[model samples]
Target: MEEDIQISFLNKLSCFFLIVLFLGCDTPGKILIKNETQDDVIYRYYKKETDENVAIDTVSIHVPALSEKYIILGFGSLWTESQLKSYIQNLQKIELIKATDTIVLKDKVEIYNYFKKRIKGVHKDEIEIIIK
Candidate 1:
């Protein structure tokens, strides 16, 4: 009986680890933004606010030069519109700023883009944005 219990415990532990490893591979829905510049760049991801109209939620994250940043959404493409978070289903935007200068540059930002027009009933698991 003792040996059987120990074996059962080991099997459960092994199954748990395998489940975690599989789930940790990547986000179901993710936006990959790449910074092709030679210097680091700061960017923002815009999501509409859920509770208030005309309100917004902005995520400011930076990527090392020649690297990429991933914006993981709460729900994946397989999720229906009703199942997705309100902010994520709305229009998604990204603002790219050139950060080579030292003066906390604000006005010199180069371009603005509409990352996703609108996440409709059907979407993709991955979207990639390349910024120059």
Candidate 2:
């Protein structure tokens, strides 16, 4: 009985380690590199606030080498429409930039990216979107 119990415990330990290793291989985010000939830099910014649980907003920017040109901007989940609209408008007004491209907004539970000239401030609770 003692030997059987020890074998069972060892099996569970090995399975747990394998599960962790598998998960560590994949991360949560939307960023990919293309055109290896060019030296481009990718950046990710995260801002968070919490009431009870933590809420986070992430921004990803890809700057091309030897130029002021950027290719991509990503917005992770937790960013609402009101927040995005306000952020875009503020960037246009303050930074003197406009949206030269469009981002596809889809209803999926995966990490999402929305390109922008800049990201602005957060939205107030009064402008919340009701899902009901």
Q: What is the C-alpha RMSD of each candidate to the true structure, in Å?
A: 8.1, 13.6
In candidate 2, the residue pairs with backbone N, CA or C atoms under 3 Å apart (3 or more residues apart, or in different chains) clash, namely: 75-114
State the lDDT of candidate 2 residue by residue for 34-125, as single tens digits: 32323544444444444437555555555554334332233332235554454343221111111342223332221222333222223211
lDDT (CA) for every model shown? Answer: 0.59, 0.38
Q: Which candidate is the best by TM-score?
A: 1
- Candidate 1 deviant stretches above 4 angstroms: 1-27, 53-55, 78-93, 100-123
Highest-scoring model, lDDT: 1
TM-score of 1: 0.49
How accurate locally is residue 13 in candidate 2, as Cα lDDT from 0 to 100?
Answer: 99
